[model samples]
Target: MSQKSLLLTAKQGSFAVGTTPIPKPGPGQVLIKIQSAALNPVEWKIQAYGLFIEKFPSVLGSDIAGTIEAVGEGVTGFAKGDRVLNQGTRGDNNEFSGFQQYALANADVTAKIVSSLSFDQASTVPVGLATAAVGLFNQGKSNSAGLYPPWEENGSGRYAGQPIVIFGGASSVGQYVIQVAKLAGFSPIITTASLTNADYLRGLGATHVLDRKLSAEQLKAQVSSITSASIQIVYDAISEADTQVAAYDLVSSGGTLVLVLANSIPESKRTSDRKIVNVFGNVNAPDNRATGASLYKQLTRLLENGSIKPNRVEVLPNGLQGIVDGLKKLQAGVSNIKLVAHPQETA
Candidate 1:
């Protein structure tokens, strides 16, 4: 068997189609016939910044929906031809990263795809959905004031009702945050986005959509009027310097702010009681396997049951070569969209 994948040849470069021998699954891994793969901002950022990638000619793509072609040793509960979606981080450095015609995925991070959703829809779930899920539930204690609904039943308890705010609610991650916040029973899922996206944000479960372009004082006042409780939990998908400062003001002492981007929080802005969190969505990167696997499993259940929905996907028709164009579109700030490359035309 043979496979073809999109490869980034150098820093700030385009993806070239590269061919490789079909790879066999290793222990606890499965080989997938990749049907669809989603594009993310990190794909272009990494290409431009040369971060995280260890070498050139690297495959890029972290969200995948496919069919398992073969199962490796120690893998059970999944068989050949089983439809699936995987968070493709751990296997990213391996032979498959979802941009290819075929890729390998660890059994632990792969989940059976929901039958009701299309492969394109499933392809959009892994990274953003998993990140939102972990941000809301993994690190912090569940809120009991009925501010947000709980996504799961931990032995400890569920999120009873917490006032949570998702900044950048129009972004893909922010959209997931809103839905998850609503499902988790978070009351008044407040968010900040441009006026154009306000209606969309409300439809996705945001109780209030404040314009992010507003002056800091106006933004703060709007958030303050909605809830006297200092925002207990904030998921800042944008994580800009200005946003971080605003987030600090919105949260009370002892509140938690989860950031999807890296190190946007300034030390001066942090209160002794407030907690700042950085969410690296790649949970399967060796060190985080134990924790990542548990979260991936829960996320799979949520997707299968329709507890959360996949974001809007803009499918590129031209397969591997379209990756370069897709990346350019993302870099230019494409709106209300997540781009997906369809490796299998029939899919």
Candidate 2:
């Protein structure tokens, strides 16, 4: 069988809608007939810099929502026609990527989509939620704060009265971080974003949403006023050099600074008292698989109960082809929205 997919024709090449053979699921996997696939900054970076995906004619996407088209051997909990969402692996083979009409997802990290969410909303969950979950709760990892997961037994509200500052709170990952931090009982959850996003971020569990335009000094002063307790954990979802520096400065001595990108803090400013971890958010990665699977198990309930919410979505038109323009818009910048495409509607 054949299906339409948006292909990165070569490293640093243009994206194009093209036909590819639909893949059958292997053992422990299920084939997904993709309904919606969301774009991430990483996809644009891949095309612009030839990063992660080395293979030419590759498919690039991490978040998808769809229905199970077929189930492979040993996957018992899921069957054909079940609505689900999946986190596709970066640099994984084409059959496991999300840009295609049909892709295979390992059963362990796939979760059913609750009735309340459209495929667009469910499609926004995987990558953003995984990045937040793995970055904050993956124990024994430098990339995480090693905090107890709230979804686990006796883990809820473990950090009551503690404070966390998430840079880029309006970002998709930052939005999930705010929600997850609330579940973990981090008091006075603080985030930085444009003032326009304050109410929305607050609704997502952020207690304070500071303006992104603030200077590092100004932000520090504002954060200091919010909590007297040492600010121990800071998640820099933006992770740009300036944001990293600002975020790193907010971490109290002996605290951990979590970044979604490479550590850009200059050595002269770094101190032994502070630790910086650049998170690799892909759940399919060897280090994060266990946590990813665990999160998937609890995801449906989390969404159903409104404990975690999807980012507001803007669906692009033209199906897979629409993603080409979406990528450009993403590269230019967007706020408080996830851009999604309906791969099955490809022309």
Query: Which regions in candidate 2 have their CA more than 4 angstroms from the true location?
Result: none
Residue 67 accuracy (lDDT) in model 2: 98
Best by TM-score: 2
Tens digits of per-residue lDDT, candidate 1, 1-347, equal: 77787878866666788776788999999998988899999888888887777677788888999999999999998999889988776223648587888888889988887678889998888888766766655543321111222543542224445688888898888888888787777787889988898887787889899988888789888877988865678888888888877776787777788877765666776678877777666656554454557656676677776667788889997898887888889999977788998876622
Every model's Cα RMSD, please? 3.5, 0.8
Kindly give the number of clashing pairs for every candidate.
Answer: 15, 0
Segments in model 1 whose C-alpha atoms lie over 4 Å from true places: 90-92, 140-151, 154-157, 286-288, 345-347
Any idea what lDDT model 1 has? Answer: 0.77
Candidate lDDT scores, in order, read 0.77, 0.92
- lDDT of candidate 2 over 1-347, digit per residue (tens): 89998889998989988899998888999999999999999999899988987777999898999999999989998978999999997674888888879998999999998888999999999999999999999998776878899998888899999999999999999999999999999998999999999999999999999999999999999999999999889999999999999999999999999999998899999999988887888888888998889888998899999999999999999999999999999999999999999998887
Name the candidate that leads on lDDT: 2
Candidate 1 residue 210 Cα shift, in angstroms, is: 1.6
The weakest ten consecutive residues by lDDT in model 2 span 89-98
